[model samples]
Target chain A: MLTAILIMTGIAIVLGAALGYASIRFKVAGDPLVEKIDAILPQTQCGQCGYPGCKPYAQAISNGEADINQCPPGGEEGIRKLADLLGREVKPLSEEHGTEKPKSVARIDEQVCIGCTLCIQACPVDAIVGAAKQMHTVVAPLCTGCELCVAPCPVDCISMAPLAETVETWKWKYPVHELRSAA
Target chain B: MISRLFNFRGGVKPESHKTESSGTPIDQAPLPKRLVIPLRQSIRSTARCLVEPGQKVLKGEHIGQGEGSLGTGVHASTSGTVVEIAPYPMAHASGLETLSVVIAPDGEDRWIDRVPFDYRKVSREEALGWLRSCGIHGMGGAGFPTHVKLGSGTGIDTLVINGAECEPWITCDDRLMRERAAGVLSGAMILRELIGARRVLVGIEDNKPDAIERMRAAASTIGDDVAVVAVPTLYPAGGEKQLIRVLTGIEIPQGKFGTDFGVQCFNVGTAHAVHRAIHFGEPLLSRIVTLTGNVAHPGNHEVLLGTQVAELLALAGPKADTDRYIMGGPMMGIELQSLGVPVTATTNCIIAASPTLFPPPPPEQPCIRCGECARACPADLQPFELYWFSRAKNFGKAQEYHLFDCIECGCCAYVCPSHIPLVDYFRFSKGEIWARERERTASDQARARFEFRNFRQEREKAEKAAKLAAKAAETRAKLPEAAATAAGTAAAAVAAEPAASPEDLKKALVAAALARAKQQKAAVTPKNTDSLSAETQAEIAAIDARREKRNTQDADKTP
Candidate 1:
């Protein structure tokens, strides 16, 4: 019985070592998924997703507390792409986050003269680079076009202006109106 | 044990919670005054809104038309005066707006017309056409246009009718299969006609013996058109790939469609929808919605389209402060934020009654050294490995373990003694990956646009230089002999400069011309609001916005 016990211990040691070695040797490095999810976010750096920023949201997505449909800025296409990646059923954007709006930038009217600077403080992307209690102007170029500043405006001076169509921003959509003028 | 050899690994094992409200007959909900019929309920594109707002729309009247071959028409759920044709809150978590034609229902629920055809005489194409015209789509959770499915999946040899209602608390399909066997068979015939497969297999789970028996009887009556196969009861066995495998002993390769195996599957309820579409030219308006879970009355009810979920809950006698509202089955269902979400074609069941339906989410804890989750995983993955990788946010290792194949069935979480919420981890990883990808794509697009814009600006500069040179040459050419001679002598001397080549001389002339052009270009700008076209100013603002946030984090991470 003693001999048997000794042999069992020897066998157990061998098996455990084999498993331990495999664990170390086969240890794959770096998850490619976080990168992919981070790529899909709007990157507006807005906490509208209930996270500190887009990267955190991407991490949260990897964690599953947030739904793929929460990025209203990314719209349906973004949700669909996320669904494809995660293999989750692609439902419409989660309504709690808000709906898809026309791409807009906040334009603060200087003449309104309130100078409350509330909108500036609320800018998630630091799009409003201005002094406190002074006439604040929106740095349109820095804005992610998130429109988060509109809500915080005290006197309602901030208005969302639909970004203009330009050659740079425009891509030829797959010609959805193919039948037009042909018939 | 034999089945275990082939099934995929790593499924979830969520509590069925079916007992909250099952084993009861369906109760009727009080009809609302206005039934808001959305034009785009099915997976297909929204049907054309045929009826203008404020017109009297009769029940079953074709109010919306299916677009081309990939659409289903919209029908009025009940006869009433059309109240509005405007955007309203849709049955989505987004609370997004959709075009809805609201009808204030009168006392009399009436259908406008019923165009019935002989089922026997209808050709396959004709039948498919009728199905499209009638506006039928898969009532299964996917809501794929039904006619599109019937349109041949090339080389298909088997038609698997999904009766494996495995999700707990959802019995609408079971009740429909048991009660309307003949209609289902007729619908199957239409499908058989749609795709001339070697054989049609009807797979009902053993749990539903009555449904199985009824379906078998229906098959016998239909003769050799369809074959009845009873698969062992298993959660998510109704999944097209899973059901197909149970019937035909085949597995769908990952990242491939079921058609690769020469098989097609349809929900039993979707078949009935097909039958309604083919027999009576009826658009898919109403469907058998399972009213169960935490409710007093638990069964199947044929609810109209665009029915408010709140009213449906009232019908079920939902408890005040019911904890959860799940659309479809608990395993794959979504949690709804509000009861105001309208019911659509894809809404098969609404679990809206129990505190037990979705108890407070399980307290998450570190996984113990237990292999229960591995044993329970249907996909045969070492979910423990996935769990470690997922928890660490090491998506690479998780993917190596076939993370994408984990169906998020909650089997691992259910079986886990530690209750790790493993699915949530996997979900989070996937979402992060997607978010990253979107950022990458937008950056790539931005980069390409920037490059193209720079190239265009360069070309414009070159063109202006050429124009200025041409103007100088023309002015020189028009000069009189003595003046022209003087000019030529000066030009020749400049050209003859020892340091200057012919190319240099040409470049110098071009530079002088370009300087002039630059001044002109600057001068040409509209000084005031009136001078600036609204279109031009808008363009300038957009360009300015583009320059501000040029670098995106996603672009830096993804290739």
Candidate 2:
């Protein structure tokens, strides 16, 4: 009986030591999953989610400290993608922050500008180009319509304008009813 | 000669209403007062409009130039003055708007400088450039650029000229072959020489015996290298892959072009255009369009590129009770939203749907999984499964079933007991998938830019901190002996951070956190409101009073 007990104890210790060594040897170095989640995000850096930027929100999501629905700029489609990735149930976008709007870019009125650099500092994507006491202009293509620069502009020159769709940017709209109207 | 032919997996043979329109010879459609030519006519590319409003353009003069390597040129069909350059209805299923140049024809069918070249004497590249400049593209349903198609015919063994005219009630190609067989055959020979092909086969459906006889006689005059063979009558047998398979007994693999198998196919009308561009120095300004169904006269007419369909229908004598107008054949056509849409190079047939002739399809019913659609699918895909997944909006599942392989032929729809509109579902699924892919690409770009911006910000912060530390060290080095001691401690505090211990690192982190918290607290303080108006000052006082009252009320409630 003692020998059987001793064999059982020896087996447990051997397995335990093997598992412990394997755990240390095969430890994951970096969180690739968080990187993937960050890539899926729209990356507007709007700060509407109360996070400083998209990366901080991604980290919070990975750590389970923030819900996927908090991103207003990302909207419902973004939530659906996050749900698919994290294996969670899809939820409606959190309405307390904002709602999804058509894509827009911030346009700064050059004529009304008082050469202040506050918007440049407020921009997360560094899309605005200017120096201190110099008129700033928003690079149209690079601006993410995050609306972060609007609040810091004391003159209120920055306004969101919907992106004009050209033929190159036009996408096929679905035919809702097969027969629309007869000739 | 290809003695034995091959068969595709599945196809349905619809009733051929060819004799309705094939009864007479081709007619020249009269020019309309105004021609609204869309800037984009080719499927592969959308040309950029070169002419502005109020500009006078001669016949065959370029109005739009190819914007990309794969695009075709757009020319003025006749001498005209540009009236407007704006968006108009396009010949698409969605009837969406596209930019067009509306021209008021000057009533003079004058020609630009016609420069026909001996294709044999000219280099292949030169010939292709001429064709591209002439706005020559396949008159087949897809409207692929002829130069692009010809460019892929290198080292081709068999060049198949598709004269099948398989769809019912569309006899444009048939009439073209019957009337201009010599031109078509000459074009085929030119194409064969250009591509350096050893064998040329002209495949025509057996139903059009007249076209077959004419094409055979024409091919006989050309060497034994060209053979005109009649293929079996099938719904989509004229499809590039299907015709290639039927003629050469070779099946192009899925998601591959016919050229990949050392075989290339061009439409009979496209061949005629090639011949005209090389021999007669004529640019492709017009094509044979069939106006049929519920019209007094159902026949072929050589309609100019920018003429409105309403004008063409007026000549064809449309019945007063016509219900609708379809652009192509009944199987693979789009219903016209308005007759004002112009007839581009791709408008082969316009069927006037009437209550007595063509009726609306019955409402859709649920699928019982009978699998008739699967059997009728020409691409050999399971249509029922595609239907289920697409209806459920499970794009991944639909993709797994190879949803894009569907040819949108409406063969399954014709045979479906449920009248499922299977092609519509497939198109919707494909569009949704493309939209998602575009969204993903945009998101990826945004992410990269955002990440780069963040990295730049971090680098700038580190550089600033390093510069500040170096400046402090430099100032300490120049300080006096009494002050140098104090400055030396400050320099040491900056330099000592390089080799910190675990305890020191923790303390440093705590100190940094405290400093950041204090900085944030300081940043929250309001400032720079010294010169406020009386109205603003009263508003601030009212807000302060409300806050004080809320605090007192909260205190009372707690007690």
Candidate 3:
């Protein structure tokens, strides 16, 4: 028993020392799982997710504190991807947050400007450009339609506008049999 | 020249309607008053308009610049003044609009200064660069830039010129070979020289003996490198992969090109255009289009690019009952959305639709899982499996079945007893897959942007917190000893000391609880009794007497 105990003690000490060295030598700085989950999200920076931003929501998801269905901007497809990545059962989207809509960009009516810098502060992506008391304009491509800026604006000049489909961006819709019969 | 030609796995024999279009000699189309030239003609095209409205352009003058290395250039088909530069309907299967340059042709049809490149004096790369600027592309429906195709021509062995115009009613290639045999052979020689190939094999379908004879005569005049051979007249024997397989007996691997196997293919019309571009300094401005079906004169015409289909149909004399038009052969053609859409490099045939000649497809029936479609697939793919997966939207399974390997040849559709539009399903699935991939890329980019924004916000917050902490530390360090002692004493007064023992803590807690109970009882005492009526006072006195008696009885019982 003494010999066995001594051998086990020696093995434990060696393994513990190796593990300690490895922990310091090859330390992972950030949570890669959170990073992967964040990568899967639509980077709308639209806090329809209860969290402050996509990264925080991703961190919460990695920590098993947030449900994958809370993000309306990510939509069903995003939820499906997250479920596939995290090995969880797919669930319906939680209706309390919002519903998934077609992609849009936040457009500001520059003419109705009472440019309180409140909107500038609330924007996560910094897509809106303006001075403290001047008119503001939205860079359409960069704006994520977060709607976070809309609540902060006193004049309520900001609104989400659906993107126009050009020939380049047009997608082929599935043909319906009933529709074909009319043709 | 005839060799032991090998056969591919599956192909159907469609009726060759060549005599309908090939009866007469090829004719030159009358220059229209206006030409609406679409800037984009090739796949993944990025043609940028170079001229503004009202700018005078000569015939063969470059009117659009190629935006990317793979983009094809566009030139004026006839000397004309630019009338409009705006979005117009283009001849595409999707019936979409593209940015086009509208030119009103001048009656003179003036030519620009011509400068031909000497192939023997310059490097093959330089010759190809000249060809790139000439706006030449494959006229075999694909419209691929010929320069890019010949870019990888180094160390190639065999160059196969596809002269097999095997589609049912399309005889553009047949007429091009019969009319311009010498020009086609010259372009083939240039191709063979550029690719440094040992031999050039021209595969024309045997049904067109006139084209075969003319091409053979032209080849004999030119040296021994060019051999004009006749392939068996089969539906889609003119297909790039099919013709390659028939001539060389090599099945090009999936997701690979003909050049991957030391072979390359070009259309005879493309060769003729190359000859004109290199020898005559002309760009691909016109193409021989077959105008047949519900037309009085069913023949081939060398129609200028950007000529409206309506104008071309008028020249061919369309029947009064012609309801629609197809841009290519009936087997793989798309119906024209409007007759006003202009033709492009890929428009080889335009069939005016009538009730008798072109009837609507029968209503689709349920797939019986018969293996006939599989046997008829030219690419040797299982059509029923693709059909089921696509219909079910199981794209992953469809992809696993090599759905993209399908050439969209319509062979399976032609042979299907169910009359199902298999090619349409394939096209729809491909478009969906492409759109999904684009969305995935966009999502990834958005994620990066969001992550970066979050990171910046976090860093800013951390910096703010650190600055506040530093400010507080600075203020504390600036205070003298006496002030620090005074601050410490004030802080100590507010901070209560801990209990010394468990008994002391219990006694303190019990005293606090008794005091709280007594305070609560005192607060519940009745108020404002001075305004009571006389009867109320008497009732209160009686209740009080009863309470006192009850209290004495309870006390006695407890004792």
Better of 2 and 3 by lDDT: 2
Q: Could you tell me the lDDT of residue A139 within candidate 1?
A: 78
Better of 1 and 2 by TM-score: 2
Q: Which pairs clash (backbone N, Cα, C closer than 3 Å) in model 3?
A: none
Q: Which candidate, 1 or 3, has the higher DockQ?
A: 3
Sort by DockQ, best first: 3, 2, 1
Q: What's the true lDDT of residue B227 in model 3?
A: 83
Clashing residue pair totals per candidate (backbone < 3 A): 45, 0, 0
Which wins on DockQ, candidate 2 or candidate 3? 3
Q: Please, what are the lDDT tens digits per residue for candidate 2 over residues B405-495? A: 8889899989999888888888888888986786677666666777787789899999999999997666444433323233356534743
Say which candidate scores most in lDDT: 2
**Segments in model 2 whose C-alpha atoms lie over 4 Å from true places:** A1-29, A107-143, A153-157, A162-183, B42-44, B468-559
Model 3 residue B505 CA deviation (Å) reads 40
lDDT of 3 by residue, B1-559 (tens): 4468989888889888788989888899999979999888754877888999999999989998887888878899999899999888887766778889999999788999988878789877788888888888888967888898886667688999999988899998998898899999999888888887888999998999999999999888877767888888888898999999999898998899888888989999899999998898888889999999889999999899999988888888999999989989988888999888998888999998898887888889888989898999989899999988888777888899999999899999899999988888887777778777876786666666666777898899999999999975664443333232333554233223444565644444444446557767988867767789999999999999999999999999997
**Stronger candidate by TM-score (1 vs 3):** 3
The 10 consecutive residues of candidate 3 chain A with the worst lDDT sum are A174-183
Candidate 1 residue spans exceeding 4 A from truth: A1-183, B1-30, B39-52, B62-72, B85-99, B117-133, B151-153, B356-358, B388-401, B481-559
DockQ, all candidates in order: 0.02, 0.23, 0.27
Q: Please give the C-alpha DockQ score of model 3.
A: 0.27
Give the interface RMSD values of the models in order: 14.9, 3.3, 2.4
